[model samples]
Target: MDWDDLRIFLAVARAESLSGAGRGLKLDAATVGRRIARLEETLGAKLFVKSPQGYALSEAGDRLLPHAERAEQAFAGAEEELSGIAGQLSGQLRIGAPDGCANYLLPQVCARISDANPGLEIQVVALPRVFNLSKREADMAIAVSRPTAGRLTVQKLTDYHLSLAAHRDYLSKSPSIGTKADLRAHRMIGYIPDMIFDKELDYFAETEAEVVGLASNSASVQMHMIQAGAGIGIVHDFAIPFAPGVVRVLADEVRLERSFWLIRHADDRRSERLTRFAEALGQGLRDEVVRLEREAAQSGLAPP
Candidate 1:
C-alpha cells in the first residue's frame, strides 16, 4: 500500500538478498529486513522464500511484481517531469553494453551527451552478457544481437564491420598468411567458444582456425591480446583507432558485419526524459561509429 515499502520490495526482489538491497537503498541489512517484515505483515502475505541462494519471490510476490513496477515507473516519470526541462536531461542514466562498445565507442558518445546536459550522470556497465531489463539492471542496454523475448523495445543502432587483425610486428615475424588456409599455421586470438553469449558474436565460425590459442570473453581483452602480438583475431573496425599497433589482416578476404541494438524496457516509453535521452544516445552512437571507422580506414588499418 505504501510506495516506500513497494520501493524496498522492488529493490529486494531485484537484488535477491537483504544486504544486496540495503547496499542499493543505502540502508543497513537489519533495517531492510525489518522493513520487509513490516511490509509482509501489512500485506498479510509472504513475499519471499529464503534459501541459501537468497530470497526468491513467492506466488504473492510474483503477483505483486507488475503492480510494483508500474508504480515505480509512474513515480520516476513524475520526478523526471518535475525536475527536468524540455531539452536537457538530469539525474542518473545507466547503460549496459558489451565490453567492445563500452571500451571503444561509449566513452566519446556518452561524454558528448553529458557535456550537453551537465546535470545528467551517466554510468556505463560493461559486461559480456545480456542485461536483465526486468530487474532494472540498467536503464537501457546496447546489445550485439536483437533479443527475441522480453517486455522490451529494440531499435537497430548501427551495422559495424569486423576484420581479421594482428600486430604489424607479429605478421612480419609469423608465417606468411596469404589465405584463410594459412591461418591454420598460426595461433589465433578470439572469444572462448563456450562463452560466446550471442550467436552474432561467433566471429570465428567462418574461419579455418581450429582453436583459439588465446581467448577472452571481453572484446577489449582480445584486442589487447592482438595488440600485444599474441595472435590474429577479429576486431571491430570502429575500435581500430584505439589500438594503433594493431593492423588489419586479410582485410579484403575476411570481413564480418554485425549490428548493435538499443534495448529498453517497453514501459519506459511513457518517460519523456528517457525518450529524449534515447534519441540523443542513438544519434551519438551513429556519428561516433562513423567517425571512428573513417579514422581507422584513413590510418590504413581498415577497409575504406
Candidate 2:
C-alpha cells in the first residue's frame, strides 16, 4: 500500500469530510476522494461508509487508525533525527493553553522560538477545556493545575495574580464597596458556573457574593463586559494594563493567586527541540510577570 494513500486516508478520517480533508492536505476535493477510493481498492477493503453526514470509518478504517498513527510517529522521528544531525529543529510543535494566557502570553514566546529555529512551526490551541496530553492533543501544555498521574513531566511555569476590578465609569456610578459585604449589592461579572473548566478557575470563593450578575466562559469576554461597565469582575493582574479604564478594586483586601504548570509527555522529554522550546516558554512567562510587577508599581496598582 502507498504511504501517501495512508496519509490521505488519515487526513480524511480525522476531518470526516472530503472538502475538509482536502483543505488540510492542500488537495482538491476530487483528488482526495479519488485517493481514498484507490486506497480502499489497494487494500481490498471498504474503509469508509459515505453518508450525508460525511464519511464514517468502516471496520477496516478503525483497525488502520492506530497503525497509521504509528507510521506517522516513525516518520516524524526519522525527520527529527535527520534535522538533529544537521543542527536544526524542523516540523510542527503544538502547544495547548488556556485562552486568556494564550492571548496574553503565547505569541511573543512562539515568535522567539520560531526566530531561533527557522525551520520549526508552532501551533497554538487556546481552549477553555484542558488539553489531553495522553492522546497527543498537544506537544506541550500550559495548565492551571498540574496533572496528578500520567506519563508526563511537569514543572512550575509561574505564579500570576488576580484581583477584583471594574471600569472607572462602572465604579463611579455603581454602589460603593467598602468591604466584602458591600459587594453584594453591586453587579458582578464572572465565569459561567457550570462551564468552569477546572476547580482552580472558580475564583468567586474569594468574594463574599456566591453568584455573578453576568457570566461568560471566556476571560476576555468577562474583561470586555467589565470594561463596558457591565459589572465588576475578577481579572488577571497582568491584563489590567492592556485594558485601559479597567482598574483593580480591593487589591489589598482581595488578592487571588494562581500558578501555571508546564506539562509534556514523558516521551517528548528527551527531544532537544521540545526542551529548548519549553525553556523559552518559561523564560517568556517569567519576563512577563516581572513586567507586570513593574507596571503595577508604576501605575500605583500594586497590591498591598
Candidate 3:
C-alpha cells in the first residue's frame, strides 16, 4: 500500500472514527471513508469494525499498526535530516511534560534550549502524562512515569524532598507540631482527588493528616493556601518551596520520589537534529537536577 494511505490508516485507527480523522486532516468525511474503504479493498481484509459508538481496529489493522508507526518515524527522521543540512536548528520541536515539571523543573533547561538552538522553537504542551511518542503526538517528552517499553530511554532527572510545613506566623500562634501524630489536629490543605502527582501519597492515610481542605488541580494553588495558614500541607521542594512564608514544620524521614524520562521514537534516534536536541536537553536536565537539589538543601529540605 502507498505510504500516504498508511498515514490515513494510522489516523483513522487512532481517532477511531472516519469523521474524527477527517476533522484532523481537514478532509471531508466521505473522502476519508472512501480512502479507507479503498485501502481495505486493495488489501482484501477489514481494517476497522464500526459500531454506533465509533471505529475500532480489527485484528488485521492491529497487525499493520506498528509497522505503519515505524514507517512514519522514518519519514519524520528523513524530513528532519534534510532540514538539518540547511545548517541551523529551526522549526517547531513539540515537547510534552506534566504541568508540574513545566512549572517547577523545566524552565532552566527550556531556557537553555532556546539559547543554544536559537531558531529551534519549542511547542511546550503541558500534558498530565507522557504523550504517545510512537503516534507522533510529541517529538519528545519529559515524563514522570518510568519507561515501560523496552525500546525507550529513561533517566533520573532528580529527586524532590518534601517537608511538613506551615507559615511561621501560624506556627507562632499555634504550638510547634512534633511527631506524625500531631498532623491529625491540624487542618491540611490537600490536592483534588484527580491530581496527577509525581508519586502516590496513599501513605498519608497512615499519617495524622486531617485533610480538611481541598483545592483545584494546581499544586501551586495548594501551596499558597497552606502558606496562608489555611492548614498544614505537604508541598514538593521542586513545585512549591520557592514561595515566601512557607516554612518547614518538621523534617521527614519519608519522601516521595519521581524521575523524568526523555523518550523519543527509537526509529529516529539516528537523525541529526533529533539526536542533538535530545542530547542537549538531557544535558540541561542533568545540570538542572543538581541546581534544584542545591536550592532545596539550602532551604533545609530533605532529599528523596
Q: Candidate 2: misplaced stretches above 4 Å? A: 48-59, 81-92, 131-140, 146-156, 262-271, 301-304
Model 1 scores what on Cα lDDT?
Answer: 0.91
Q: Tens digit of lDDT per residue, candidate 3, span 1-304?
A: 9898998998888788888888878998899999999999999999999999899999999998889888877787777767663466767788888766677767778787888667788878886555777556777777766767755656555554555667666666764476777667777766565664545433355356756465546556767787777876766665444666666655664355556667776766766777788777777777776776566556653121
Candidate 2 C-alpha lDDT tens digits along 20-105: 88988999999999999998888899999999999989999999976886676666667777776356567888999998788877
State the displacement of the C-alpha of residue 240, model 3, in Å, after optimal TM-score superposition. 3.8
lDDT (Cα atoms) of all candidates against the true structure: 0.91, 0.83, 0.70
What's the true lDDT of residue 173 in model 3?
70
C-alpha TM-score for every candidate: 0.96, 0.79, 0.80
Off by over 4 Å in 1: 301-304
Q: After superposition, how far is residue 55 of candidate 1 from its true place, in Å?
A: 1.3
Q: How many backbone clashes does every candidate have? A: 0, 0, 0
**Ranking 2 against 3 by lDDT, winner:** 2
Reference-based TM-score, model 2: 0.79
